[model samples]
Target: MIALPFLKSAPPPLQGERLYLRPPQLSDYKAWATLRAQSRDFLVPWEPLWAVDDLERSAFRHRIRHYDEEAAAGTAYPFFLFRNTDSRLIGGITLGNIRRGVGQNGMIGYWVGEPFAGQGYMYEALRLIIPYAFTKLRLHRLEAACIPSNERSIRLLEKAGFQKEGLLRSYLKINGMWQNHLLFSLIEDDRWR
Candidate 1:
């Protein structure tokens, strides 16, 4: 198991020019529920099927507990994105399923509220997390997979310097169905190339 230095406390917020990322807090339930509720139509296609009480405060509390456990285990870092100017909750991003030792890699995933979509916020979030993963976390590679139909995600990953790897057949269940995903990856060496 990897030795996580921040096990005692959550990592400090990551700052960007116009956005910031910090771990989810219980107090954020209202904002989080509002955003997810408002963006449900936009997000449903790419995400897993939402439970009946997905937006409920109790469900969010459970999600937070799961996030805390993952972070403590050094297997995931979950964050909520907030606009620096207005402090509005805009989206979320995660570096999850981490593999330590020889693997030294993790998976990247994200979602932007509909209002914040197409505005470059997710890209900025990616820029911040990439360095945090590669440098602070000492990870050697980062991977992301998106449904083949997700053009925006493809563009985002490509713009962030991830190269298309291959197709993952029936890779994940999204919206109640198994879907194929295109794999993309960036190695530490790619950063310096």
Candidate 2:
């Protein structure tokens, strides 16, 4: 078996013309909860639920613990995407479910603030994250799965150069129901070698 390399506590914060992606923190709680809760309807179809607990600082503290552990183990990078120039936490994007060794891959997941949707922020976050995953973390592939009807998400992945590999039937349980997702991925060294 290949020995696991020590993981970085955090990836260097990423920047773009308008946005930056950084590790989550307790200070981000209020903004994160507000945005996510306000976007409940928009996010519900895509996510599980807006647990009352998810809106609490105590819950966020627990979440940060899990996030920090995942970071140390090199298994995940759950980022809060912000608009740097404005200092606004617009949404979240996570490089989750990472696997090392011969696979060297991770999955991408994200959501944009309700009001911030259609402004290309999700695209910007994805653009920054894909390269970060493949180049900095040396991951071999970046994968994303979207509900076939989630046009915005599918569009973002395609714009970032992920190709559809297949459709999974009842691949994941979302909002308490088994749902389908169209799987997409980009192999490293293919576009950014």
Candidate 3:
């Protein structure tokens, strides 16, 4: 796989005031499964339909392998968010669909366990990943999309300085149906503004 210069090595764990982000691992299955099970109802509406074996150990192993491949190919960086105080897994974030050359862009996607929602963990995760995407990965723009009805995501994107671009018609098949999504973006030059 061709590697971008900036992604020649796996990213170091990103540290923040209340949490840190690291890649998924085999040892994380139990915590990950428990969290997802608890948050299934909370997350399902905003996500693609989950496979019957989505939380099974074997499926998680496949997910880890896929994450490894995406990272190796410099197409995406996926991280699991963990609280600092007790080292509990709180959520996850990804900078995916990376475009190189003139585009120099990527898409951001995230999810937080229900118990950890509305607590600013996702915001901090964004704070860490945005700079990493801009400086370390040299992305010129970062984009995110969410279902229009997802007020929480809309607020989070705005708070993180992403400007609403427009609506995408049936952009993603979420929850087993094609759903309209609002697109938001933050350019590298917009970071400090």
lDDT of each: 0.93, 0.87, 0.94
Model 3: lDDT of residue 137: 94
Q: Put down candidate 1 lDDT per residue, 1-193, tens digits, no spaces.
A: 5456854456679999999999999999999999999999999999999999999999999999999889888889999999999999999999999988889999999999999999999999999999988888889999999999999999999999999999999999999999999999999989633
Go through the candidates in order and give the clash count of each: 0, 0, 0
RMSD in angstroms between candidate 1 and the native structure over all alpha carbons: 1.4
Model 3 alpha-carbon miss at residue 123, Å? 0.4
**Steric clash count of candidate 2:** 0
Q: Look at candidate 3 and tell me the lDDT of residue 107.
A: 99
Per-residue lDDT value at 40 in model 3: 96
For each candidate in turn, the TM-score is: 0.96, 0.94, 0.97
Regions more than 4 Å wrong, model 1? 1-4
- Residue range 1-193, candidate 3, lDDT tens digits: 4566767556779999999999888899999999999999999999999999999999999999999889888899999999999999999999999989889999999999999999999999999999999989989999999999999999999999999999999999999999999999999999533
Cα error of candidate 3 at position 14, Å:
0.5
In model 2, the runs with Cα more than 4 Å from the true position are: 1-6
